[model samples]
Target chain A: MTGSAVSATALIWVDGERASALPLPDRGLDFGDGLFETLLLRAGVPQFQHLHLDRLAAGLQRLAFPDCLDRVRNCLQQAAGELQDYPWSALRLTVTRGSAPRGYAAPADARPRVVITAAPLHQDRCQPGAPVALDWAQLHWSSQPLLAGIKHLNRLEQVLVANQLADLPADELVVLDAQGHVCSVSAGNLFMLERGQLLTPALETCGIAGTRRRLVLEQLAPAISIPVAETHISPAQLTAADEVFVCNSIRGLQPVTSLGPRQWHDHSVCRALHEEYVGAMSC
Target chain B: MTGSAVSATALIWVDGERASALPLPDRGLDFGDGLFETLLLRAGVPQFQHLHLDRLAAGLQRLAFPDCLDRVRNCLQQAAGELQDYPWSALRLTVTRGSAPRGYAAPADARPRVVITAAPLHQDRCQPGAPVALDWAQLHWSSQPLLAGIKHLNRLEQVLVANQLADLPADELVVLDAQGHVCSVSAGNLFMLERGQLLTPALETCGIAGTRRRLVLEQLAPAISIPVAETHISPAQLTAADEVFVCNSIRGLQPVTSLGPRQWHDHSVCRALHEEYVGAMSC
Candidate 1:
């Protein structure tokens, strides 16, 4: 329905009411003064509700918003329900320290506000045997532990790169961190093989630790190798890698065919992860 | 007065109309997907309105957001109005890609949502002139052009850092970009001098260009050097520098007395800027 009536609303919680209006100033909007999660749902139940909630809680704790998570969970439950037909939907859970009086000092006494919205999930290309091509982007990620690894709201880098790439024919671009090490894809995490061992860039300092990415590690029994990064990664390490794949919950384990000058087609670990992701999402 | 409030419905706007809520998922709030201006007002009119507008417009352009600034100015006016005289007040003007679909792509058919909320200005710190001590924060900024100089919504960095700084006695901390250059203090811009010739880091590559920063250069005249840059400014650079100061519209210009062994008892540029800022703001 292009213009044919598709209505939506932010299943909102402000102060104590399910109110659509937020009384705080526009600081939260002015700044991405918040954190959010886009979750997957199958049937009427949230696919990884606990994970999303946990992420939001951790992020709010980092953002220093008073723990108003039960209200947030309540809002999410209200918005999410069994979708008709096939299965799967996306729910976005966001929480800000409401709008503060003004400026950046976190309001000590103001209650937080939470906003959640849901949308139908069209099937993604994530599958067991399907392979995907990838490109390496010129943009380098900056090193910042304060902003790194967490799914906080500040992500203009990804949006800009994604927008630029959407114009090109490539499906995804391998982005490197400021120190010229392979960081990840725009919306997914990266893992590659070096001598038949699972290796992903330890996001201890950059790139978000995706819920599905965590699942790919924990849910599965794959033995992996990750860089013990104190800061940036070197390009020498990436060029030496054997196999490469990118992942996120929405599109699990997509095998890379290319990254900048290099090319690698066969990837068994990627295939295994893809199969595992498909089975998990459906179940 | 939290409980004993004589209530009226919070004024809301969807496409500059009187509406209670946004039916569209605003990408601004969604992906930190927008830009905003928190204008100060004494009477009904916004102080530094043009400067604020310029900054907001430039922010929108840099982020590639579909900007409807006049509509936003109208909304900001609606957000701010006559309230009982308090210490200060703020007019928070926010504009976002009205609503986007359930993806990162900027919606093809979208209406920009402009929300303005009026609130009392909170003075969290007193003795405004007692040069606020700053700590060199553990936080580091990442490199990204799409978000470098614009006050876009991806403020989780600020949010996360603000939380950390709250526990400290210092008013704020200076943040370093990943590459070791001094970016900006949280919510303000920085200026340093090596041998009397003014030098500011190039923000074209990163850091928000504060409206007040531009005003400082404009008022300082005599072609005082103001370069947009990213350089590894060693702590030695501050100690060796002849003068240092920080400025934003709200704070005006505050002299930097001590930053990592750099001391300036009475800096002339800072004093001049302070007078000019206060004089201009009073008018």
Candidate 2:
């Protein structure tokens, strides 16, 4: 399921072309009307390709594009073949409803477009589980039941969070919903420790269900336990936590060095689990 | 400030004819990474081109596109030239971080793309200030501040709202926020008249800051006044009001003839304005 290349950079393809143009009418670019996954590859093999594909499938399903599975797999394989010699890289898979009649009423038969693009890997940004200094952003995430958990195309919130923290001390940020519950970091799933139990938001109300977060819970060592991260994220509970970390498929587990004004010693639980399950990299 | 071709259905330029393809890497489709405006064209001119363009500029600024105003205007002109002589159609102008790399680290020098497309006139969906029927959708709007009211590409919320009302009515839809405030209809701004004073939600917090809303407040009848239509939207307000109407650039003014479990008579105020400012529709 991984690409065929094995270099330090990723090879990209858009509908099987190394580089091509999207018509102005594409829904992906026009409406953020698509879904995507960022997966890491080492030695030409993608880590968790099936899981990433699964998450992408779930998103496609939510958006009503279940037929993209074949195109997605084939595109990734072709891109991997091109990058067969790269040492490290990442794969991005995107699917969107192609040109519609300038409105959201997508007909049942509208053909969707697929975009798979890869770029050179960076030593930073995606080095796996670095301790990212983070803080609570002033911006409150809106409660969107329809779009709470799924990683659909709409991502202004992520872009905004990234901007708010661009000049702040936080390399990343944790956003709260209107009721003051921890949703997740700017671009990752949040996990915290209270009395040594792994905890994360349920993601049903909001926040993305990071494929890696599921892995940490179900596949990581010390037995797959329920997330100590509860669905009802209260500020008081987070403040009283013993440890915190963020998770995503591409970046793995990033230990939270700081949150708001509180700082914590690196949790051994996170380190060990990340090392075992996520292939955590050293900062 | 509007394009020279005020009468076209939409701006059409074939591939490479005028920056035809939105360079294969537009973030709009990439992230639903853009905002758009569909304005009403009457008598071969945009009713509020300057205001619409200003909103587009503000949205681009919000999105961190570092383009000069002149650059945006030039793109508008190009699109306008192709739109000449097509009367009474909706004109769509979309601005996106044109072509960029695969990820969210927006390029430092991202050259934004401008797409102006027009579709054939369809008056069936929008017909004057006649009281349009609406049903209260079960779906509550997403409360993400980062995505709130910017009119950015993320519209899954709206899509969900649209889908929920398929069994009911489509002349309009009354959507509640997660907190249960009457947000707006499917595609237009809502105004409830209380004691003849116009009331609308403060879109600064969420919802599109409507150009038609602006014109109604700033240009239309000077007798009308605006009250805070803030986030604490209550259904009681809709019932307590004497008149309710929806407004958008394309739809002009559509009065709410009925709501779920309730109905209202047409207001004289809405009809007067339609006759005076809105005029007769050509399509």
Candidate 3:
């Protein structure tokens, strides 16, 4: 499960039409002027889909992209409907500012594009209790308030961090912000249990506001009666925490077994929240 | 000249082959894990070709891209040779970590893809003496030392700034860093002359190191007996400067006539540097 692979029998669609290629001039390819969402498909139905769409809408508005949420929603629904054969699948929906002649100034009459790809997920990779190890990444995320909390395509920082993780002995890397505050993991949101309270990084200046993170903060943790706080967590505090875990849309919840020299065998809080999340996703 | 257009007769190539589309799974679109070089093609020759290629090579190395510099050079040469019919053309060369499975970790056997597009430039838009007006942009750049000088594809900041400029009265906008230090304009390197000395923002923290900027700093300024320095600049320093200008590979040099309420009527330093740059390009 550490290195999940996309199956060869993947399906693709561009603007609701089946296609294997994207236009050469799409701004998504040109400037990374786009947003993307990675969702989990359970029994042919997209889990927490409305939340994903809402996040995409907010990101598009922040990027000043023309209104194309309806088209994107339709594309996602159509793609999901076609993936009914696969019980568990992963969907990646990307919305770009579409093709333009050249230059940064988006054309007044610009049309947005939607690219959706669906691939079957291996059953073994969906285990929520799989413990993982993390190493501190040397690469730090830059703070950009305007782009923070939005899932945009300008992910070179994460790419670099992922590359770093490949050379280390960890399944994931603990990434810090430019100011030396622990922000998140390479691909997901992080939460640490300290003194019976749940705390995650506040994403006002950087990091993505993941849908699963929202689910945990708004629904799962609250249902379990855990006090949650979105605040800054220092490296020392994280290392000294009672328990730690990371979560994302596809991987509901994963307990952090080891981070550097620190190790934790107990995951009671992570288990409770993950159980609540699984129950919520089922409905 | 402010909004130069790419002519309808544009030619494109992918991976050294003539094509108008890219494979859907390319990482350049997925993660913006790529580098780009925009060059001015004159008489079938790419102006400042060595400089541009050098910058691209440095960027690719920084991004840990596969060794594809030789391949990129061949593709660029082939594209330029076919554009001999057009006297003045603009060539955009983009190199992306080619297609791969759905993951942030780059594959060891990754193949790089190069996409080059050439379009004839309007003769009128090449005027280097065109004085442009500017306004301070509300958007600020994030400081990422690892990616500061590389011309990578994560350009959403510039896209947003371009959108802001479209709504404003200025032709360009002054963009600062998170620390409120002057960085550059929306699309080019900025330089200012204050008290008979030349000053430009250092690229160690942010901003792309433009090839034309190198020409101005290394050769043109030295030849004309103008002292130059690359250091951090502030908004007050910019507004109080004797003159200001911007430069990129496509646009040789452009003087700023006014910024907000501040005005610059004397273009002696800018004119001298532009003349020297033109002479160098002609050779």
Candidate 4:
């Protein structure tokens, strides 16, 4: 949320207590041995809380951490309850494998940690902005099936791609995997409209399966009379698509108007789906 | 270093000061947006200090952080000076893009942070253990050339692999890239001896170029007339080698005696190189 009158209260919690800092030995900072969730807190309530927690649970299982899903839910609920003063806010939750010895070998008795941070968001921040300008990213995502679809803490590729966006005159950049397969935008899931069907690149080998993208494919599109599918997409295929949009929890759905040489003004499908999704969220 | 006498005067430095905690918004913890170095501290001196710093500088340049090489060196020097009481120890240095506003896009005025943590090691921890038993890793390394050969913070893959090792009776496990190319062990670099030359996987696509691996390839091998090379190694090639060994800064070299059904007892060359490297480091 940007450029709106907003009163904010920021809170940081480490393992369920109000705290200002994290230990230096935290694996989250040391090895990025963690997962995080960023969602909207509307009127002191977390939106899509179940969906976000589902992803976090899946990531925790994939990383082989001890079962702490119940504790995780409590942490989120506690954080949301603490931000009641702010009418609207952004909430973040991070879970790491706590601290460990000085090597990759995990300690026999590892305790997973949950850190929660919430900051106020302007009421108008989620309003869809102008059609985003897009370009291709210079860097490529690594193809690791084991890490695919989970929002783990290892995100250096996104950081590098974000750096490239500073020099280019574009709002977002399309990222491809090491094999040159169209993956997603630098920070969100991408969907392309082709022949009246919505297609998102399958993340079997790489990329995150974002919560908003999931809702659009499974809920919004079906209600709005559009078919959705997941398949392999190449850069050339992405360029040839009739329309495209990027979706994430923070920004919802953003329509793309241009990608370097190619340009499109038809955002009718994107607009329709976004409108329905927002309507559902507001309810 | 476990079970032995470890008089650890643990030091934690956030930026340059002695601090026990880090800010919650540090990108290193948030998104693994950083790099790290772990070197040996023997007799109050950092082993391979130049090599580790060189790699750290290259990593900083690649990550597009401001040139803080001098500051990093000063931090390491100061940390080392404080840990002089510990006879043997392991030192870790983490450099993150400081604190940032929420999101993948870095702030225009981002400040880089250097964190140093050191813990004492048992004097006998460095003693080469019995031949290691290895099995294939259930997880594969992502082939991201952009991140290959650099020690970055995004290490969830290693965490996953390490978890797998716990169930199996193995000291370490061999990891492969998505395309089935032999990569490295979960915690260190892999080198396979074949014919007369030492062959390790080429890291043009993935894996870290460890400081000890560099010393073995560039220094010990040439000095002892054992040729070295980096190539695309397959599981078949790794299994067919005359001998295989894993190396890292903390542990000089560990001979791999068994890999599933295959086994190797010849470690004369490995013992020679490790002996020479240890003698040189002690000087």
- What DockQ does every candidate get? 0.46, 0.53, 0.84, 0.77
- lDDT string for model 1 (A195-232, tens) is 65566677756788788667766664253333312233
Model 1 global lDDT (CA atoms, 0 to 1) = 0.65
Give Cα-based local distance difference scores for all models. 0.65, 0.68, 0.88, 0.85
> What's model 4's lDDT at B84?
65
Compute the DockQ of candidate 4.
Answer: 0.77
> What ranking of all candidate models by DockQ puts the best one first?
3, 4, 2, 1
Error of 3 at A196 (Å): 1.2
Better of 1 and 4 by TM-score: 4
Off by over 4 Å in 3: A1-10, A124-126, B1-10, B124-126
Docking class of 3: high
How much does each candidate deviate from the true structure in C-alpha RMSD? Answer: 5.4, 4.7, 3.6, 3.2
lDDT of 2 by residue, B49-140 (tens): 78888887787888787765676666665555454455556667777776776655577787766676765464633345556887777776
Docking class of 4: medium
Task: Tell me the interface RMSD of model 4, in angstroms.
Answer: 1.3
Model 1 chain B weakest lDDT span, ten residues long: B221-230
Per-residue lDDT tens digits for candidate 3, residues A186-267, read 9999999999999999988899999988988998899999999999899999999999999888877999999999999889
Give lDDT tens digits, candidate 3, residues B1-283. Answer: 1134333454889988888788878899999989999999886688989999999989989999889999999999998878766678889999999988888999899999999887888773345657889999999999999999999999999999999999999999999988899999999999999889999998787899999888888999999999999999999999999999998887778999999999999888999888788778742
**Which of 3 and 4 is the better model by TM-score?**
3
A36 Cα displacement, candidate 3 (Å): 0.3
TM-score, each model? Answer: 0.81, 0.86, 0.96, 0.94
Best by TM-score: 3
Model 2: per-residue lDDT, tens digit, A1-283?
2464333332446677765666556667656667888877764577778777888788777766648688778888877766546566677777777767666555567677777767656554443467888777777777665566677888777777776777687788878877778888888888888776777877666677777876776667345353443566677787778888887766777888777788888678777776577443321
